[model samples]
Target: MMIILKSKKRQPHQTEKTIQILKDKLRERKIKSKIIVLENIEVFLNEKRVVMKINNWIPSKRSPVYFRIAERYKNASYIFSKYLEMKKVPFIDNYHTFTRERNKLIQMFLLAIKGISIPKTYYSPAYDSRKIRNAARFLKFPVVIKLTEKERGEGVFLAKNAVEIKRILGKNKGQEIILQEYLDNDFDYRILVLGHKTKLGETRTRTNKREFRNNACVGAVEEFFPAEEVPSDMKKISEQSSRIMNIQVCGVDIIRSRKGKIYVIEVNFSPGFTLDEKMDELNQTADYLKKWHEKKY
Candidate 1:
């Protein structure tokens, strides 16, 4: 698997055009290749072999893996490259260039750069409490504080104002935190995408009105439906976002603000599945996996 990557500052339209140009170039190429999105690639360490799945298709480590990763995603690429080396898998880019950069921040930055609407977020690596609090104040009241690595809404906190930010920050000192502008929405949609199509959709809502997170871990429930039932715009955005992230399978979490502006909240790399019953979803997933497995094998 060979990866090549690029970027420049331009207007949103220009950026869109550049992406299209890339797609065209990809189609015109004669050699076998694939677009490697950082989020789309899953590498597992706990397994017997260092299992690496790129959009469900396992690539042989014996094949040369090149790096054309973007500036924001280079750190993550470095990480993957290091793991490949540790496993004695062949790949370009070694530990000579490596840093444990924050992945969440880079993921969001990539989405935003691609013109996907996301909440205004601030990042601060500062050790001072006041510096962090000041960054939260820039986003106004009712901000969301998220610990970069924590998932399932565990490290997510809602801060109503500066005081709340202080209180939240005090409790989680030394944690990597990101301050985000809170979009007031009772519920959010999680559209599951595989390839260019959205396989399924669900609306996640908190059981209690006071809770800010719509995570199932937080006593929240999801109402699953077919892909056709999902809003067209939502599905398109989810597919587009997934494609941009180069993730073959992903859950795109989105929200509509009070003003009716749609925003992509998060694109889960390893999204969970919780259905009241398994019928179509199970079959769909099984078939999808089988198709890829057969094609790859």
Candidate 2:
């Protein structure tokens, strides 16, 4: 069986033409396929191998799974891909890429090496008060302390002074963290990039004055814009970052400082804007998958 492991319950009826395209393509190839929602599966990992119980049945090693799981299903994709790797099953968007995307520090380092502009960030392998404090000092009083394995915008923090930094260090003792130079910005841009093309763009702004993050999941207002409307530099940055990371479809978050300097915040491996109305992003991904399946099989 060929499994299309997706994030949504089902593609919407009217606007989901792209999904139908995928279905048609699969049918043409006589590939026995089914779409399974990622959230609906139960994965169990043990000493030697990994297993997944989907509804009342299980897919054997012979079944090839393509991960249509993106955006909010980051953790789920990671776990499932790990299971697939263990079982020596072929899958799209494998475990290594997802594993690397989980670490903010690593992402920043890779982007930086590729000449992508990012905020000055530092990390420590182990918990050390002096090391963390020194990093804060270098970044100045207003520093952003981000959990190395970031969880959306939830793990990001804003520390105004040394006292606050000290408090945060104590609170998250032994936790892998990274310190970044804080950049004051009204809002940040979430630009969706796919197949080296800019597709959808949106600016996220915090509605709550106290909140520093501009995440839609955290009650921030998102004003979306089409590809043409996105700034040229941002578009270039998003494309370059996507190419560097080898993520065909991903969200590249870019923030502009008060002085109008733009910096790449982070790259979201499993970005959620594929089903959007304007761009046929999902269709493009599915097309890629069809070709990949053909080549592999």
Candidate 3:
């Protein structure tokens, strides 16, 4: 089996560790796989040649790319989708699906249209004070300002009002942003759904007062929940969200408010399982990928 990792040329320590662990697990499973650690394989894609070195076997095939994003996801799936279409190759999380899932604004739009209960949100390309002022007036107070196309909560902010937004936007200019209604929840849960199976669902809570964000990267504590503990409607919503977004593997962020109401926060197309604190997540993800490859090729 040929596997590729679209990661940074200079990866972070966590990223490197995750890749190492995945490779180790695959080896233990006796799965023949290759990790192509490069992002823009445009030359390889165009020439239809990826010289993969797996063990002593230098198998060469003009096989089309059947993969997901490894680096910045902007236009990642879009470009790959074009290649898939040209080669008539079946792949998971194509461009259209990736684009929609990557952008919080797009996910909100689709979910809202489907009558899903997502927090009220607003997105605007203009970061000028006037627009920020208008957005504050339109959206709920203590809303979130997010960079439209970034991951790991890299560009997310909790804005108290137009004043805070102006201060932040003034320092950084000419960047597209999204203002979302903040549902005041103490902790957030990231639910993983792969193909037709729910691999794992866990809650991430901020362990320190300094870190307000509950993302696992921000030193949040992760704890697993039993399948029976998963809210029934949430299960249905998560499943529908994946199918509607046309992704084989997905991550959905659901907010459980202080008052015990659940709101679908966002959907992730190329959701990452490699760096999960729990190794089971990584192993199961790798195993699922093995199963998928077995079925596909």
Candidate 4:
């Protein structure tokens, strides 16, 4: 069995760690694997024989002049995903999974159609203050702002008033920003959904003044465990979201509102396991991916 793992261009350090762990797991299972870090793909000759490609990169570069070159490398991830379409591969998640997961608004819209409750969300291009202000006004104050394509809780801010929104947009001009209702909850769940199954889930809390943000990237603690028995309806909603989006695996961030309603905050395509980083869970998720790849390939 052949497997290919792709990751973002920057953050080579963290990607290296994940690749190592995955390589070790496949090796332990006596499976042959090929891992490709996309940003540095000039090292490998383009080949069509590879099976199971995992893509983790998002097009977030500064200049469109280099986009074609970057796209060539990014497209290789799709090529590998297509290879899985032809034969039995060890493990892989396709390009569409990455694409839909990267666009927060699109993902939310899909989930909403499947009967999942999400915060009222809107998006606008950069430099359109009037349009953004209008969307914010519609959602009401204390709205959450985010870059349309980002992970690890980066490029996200909560603005209370038009002045703060204007300040943020001024600082982050020339990018797609999403404005959404801020769910009122003290804790959030980082539920790792693998193949429609919740493989490993984590709960994050803001327990200290120094760390106000409840993101593992912001130094918040992560407590990992198997999913608490999710209601059947909720399980169906999660699975349907995954199926509709064609993702083999995802990290679903969910929140509980003041009215005690559950809402899906976001879905991550290439979610990192470092926050939990436990060997057993990693191995299990890897094994599941391996099985899924076997069926697809």
Show pairs that collide, candidate 4: 87-297, 88-297
Worst 10 residues of 4 by lDDT: 42-51
Instruction: Write candidate 1's Cα lDDT for 1-297 as tens digits.
Output: 344322232237765566556656766784345555454444322112334455455555555565544554454465456555655667655642455343565556556556677787665432245555555555667888888778778888888777788888789875756777889889988888887689999888899887889988888887888988988889888888887777877788899899987788888877887765665556667778899999999
TM-score of each: 0.64, 0.60, 0.62, 0.61
Error of 4 at 77 (Å): 24
Q: lDDT per residue, candidate 3, 1-297, as tens digits?
A: 645435444667887787678768878998766665333232111011212122233323433333434434344345345435544555445543445344665566556556677776654333445555555665658877777667886888887877787877776665556676777767898778778556678888888886667887777788877546777867877777777666778888888878876788778886655454566567767888999999999
Residue 34 in candidate 3, Cα distance off native in Å? 56
lDDT by residue for model 2 (106-177), tens: 566567656688887655444345655556655676888887765677778898887788788788864656
Question: What are the per-residue Cα lDDT tens digits for candidate 4 across 1-297?
Answer: 343444444445655676678778878998765554443321101111111211332222221111111242333444333333334333333432243234775666456545566777655332355655566666788878887667787888988888888889888865556677777777787777788886666778877664335787786677776656555545555666667667768777777667877777777777777623466357757889799889989
| Model number with the top lDDT | 2
* Clash statistics: count for each candidate: 2, 1, 2, 2
lDDT of 1 at 39: 46
Q: Which residue pairs come into collision in candidate 2?
A: 71-270
lDDT (Cα atoms) of all candidates against the true structure: 0.67, 0.71, 0.62, 0.58
Residue runs of model 4 more than 4 Å from their true location after superposition: 1-101, 126-129, 210-212, 231-234, 275-277, 293-297
